[model samples]
Target chain A: MSPTNATPPSERTRVRRVAQRGRYDRETLHAIVDAAYVCHVAFADEHGVHCIPTACWREGDHLYIHGSNGSRMLKLATHGAQICVTITHLDGLVLARSAFHHSMNYRSAVIYGVFDIVEGAAKAAALDTFVEKIAPGRSREVRPGDINELAATTVLRVAIDEAAAKIRTGGPRDDEADMTREVWAGVLPLAMRPRTPIIDAAPSGTPDYVRQWHEIASANAAV
Target chain B: MSPTNATPPSERTRVRRVAQRGRYDRETLHAIVDAAYVCHVAFADEHGVHCIPTACWREGDHLYIHGSNGSRMLKLATHGAQICVTITHLDGLVLARSAFHHSMNYRSAVIYGVFDIVEGAAKAAALDTFVEKIAPGRSREVRPGDINELAATTVLRVAIDEAAAKIRTGGPRDDEADMTREVWAGVLPLAMRPRTPIIDAAPSGTPDYVRQWHEIASANAAV
Candidate 1:
């Protein structure tokens, strides 16, 4: 499938609480997924519901995840078990004049669907996409996965068609009565900023991605 | 109950994959929870599995969450529904020499349990603890939740008894064969850093927490 033109492609995807903060567009969903390095996946079995965090990335209209072939999650998901994948980026801490109105600024996306295994040549390409996401040009530099290694990994993707994004930004919205309270109210803005890269035993010159990582974080932090 | 001296207290909480990375101690679980502002809660309903992100805080041996009384998750949880709460802190991107060995450095905690409601005085106190967590001494400066506001909210807590923490740190563990590959290998560390505080229309002087926000980020980033 492609980016959802209409929000809430399914009944379960509708946002009920704080409906004003909900976004059902593809752009919002993709942005949330792309910005995250990890996502929490929710699924159920006889033992009950489980929420596990795993590395994730987005390519076009699908969100991709990979793990060992023996992974409980991948094995269960391969069987077409219904699952929910969520990515949340906590942007800041919203402080209000009243404790009741305090909230956090965050961008969160929730996708509901079943994962389809990516096999054959697409699997290798998908793995490259993930590496490229982390460091451009480095995929070619690094030794590619061997046939045995590739066989041991399972890559799965879920369509972003049934997804909803909920975002909260800016300052706190205090009640009219509480606005006059003598309190320090504002947003303690936060971002996942990069520290100075800790380069390991590189066999050659540093990659462009590593060199620019701190720069990118500084640029984002300034915003 | 105190921190578990023995790990894998229950059958389900056991970490099956990469068992060496798992820690069942309470200290590990508490640190993960304390470091997170939000948690992804997985619960099953007629609509299927749902992973929702909500503001979370740790109060001693329990993880606390609150929402409007009409919240579906709160209502369902109030009824003793078994659920899973997960908190993950992505520390860095681990770029390995081989595509197959690529991984992420993170600290995560998964807790399986049923939520119990906090009522009366304990509920109010629990909310205060959350406020204090966000801003050390600001709880006194802000107007506390009124009776009406308190009545409209529901606070739920789950014991940290059945929990496991998985953490992976340092550089990537590349395969012996790939170790000689001429690739820039290392960690691009990332952290939730505080940007400059965005002060709203405050009626008084800046608080200590707001003042120290950026400094704290700098200190953490240096580490």
Candidate 2:
């Protein structure tokens, strides 16, 4: 369930002051999350605290995370407790004249909420959802998880609540007095593009599902 | 103070595994941390737990981290509490025959220890150490932090106690039976490289300190 205090529409987080560089809208946040593959999940434990970085996939307003059943974070989350989920994309390196001014241009989202473990049929469906998120349409192509494997894995669902997205983009903004200094200043965009797919070495024709999506991603990028 | 049981020579956390896919020796681990620019620091608090991804630098077996004086994690660490510091580099995607087998090749290290705040002159030294980690000789080239700025920042040090490094590299290992499958399978090397450095807009000749390290990182890559 979403928290009642989840960021209000107007209170949504954005890059303050640098209006041109921030995006507070939900669509922008979702697009950033959709394009990324992993997230850093942080939580506190009795023995201090820890953050675990792992792969994740989103469906609607909920995020699904999987880990070994023995993982401390997973064990804690399974008890229906609040956790922090952050997804960050480092867009570029901001080289400033001043070392103190040196910073990174990045897009990041922080979500805080209690997570509920998906069990029984719900767990099975969630796994399928994760499969499709990684490689669209591949969910149905592979053999489903067997009972033993499924029982051994843990999947936790965190409802999107009280989330804030912060971003910084564009060329370096040097101090006014330093504007005319003989220093180069511009942006070097960083993008993660999919390379040729590494097919598994097993014996079988390329799965139709994999081929279809590969073609789609290529076409989208070409545009 | 470090936890008595936490000082293991080699202890794998959730992300660290010794499987054929997740193994790294001490040299590889140290090299990865030395070259990394930022690390994801995770800690827990009364309002659940928080993970803030921030810049970090290491000296010997200890890591130095600084943040806004008001940061909750900084407040907690200053009390000499245990914390988790992690550095992760995502090398590339691992496309597998099945979606479940899909993974990312990465190099990561996790250290568990209690943090001690650096104050007075020791704090200034730590700041210099941080700069040197990023640009070996550049700390002296730039103006040191003044009283106000230094006062506004909080720095904490965590000794490397229980630590482990995990790495996944090389080409994909598909199922033996899938060897003849007409699917592509190989690694697409991923790397972070420096483009032309953008100088600040102010007029000053390139600092010799910055120029000296230009060629030092030609062979290294970031995750």
Q: Alpha-carbon error at A204 in model 1, in Å?
A: 1.2
Candidate 1: C-alpha lDDT: 0.89
Candidate 2, residues B146-218: lDDT per residue as tens digits?
Answer: 6887898898888665666667776665566555545444444444444334444424655553454243223
Global local distance difference test of model 2 = 0.64
Error of 1 at B133 (Å): 0.4
In order, the B-chain TM-scores come to 0.94, 0.82
True contacts kept of 1: 0.87
DockQ, 0 to 1 scale, candidate 1: 0.71
What's candidate 2's DockQ score?
A: 0.29
Top lDDT prediction, candidate number: 1
Interface RMSD of 1: 2.1
TM-score of 1: 0.96
Q: Tell me how many clashing residue pairs each candidate has.
A: 0, 17
Residue A96, candidate 1: C-alpha displacement in angstroms: 0.5
Tens digits of per-residue lDDT for model 1, A120-169: 99999999999999998878998899999999999999999899998899
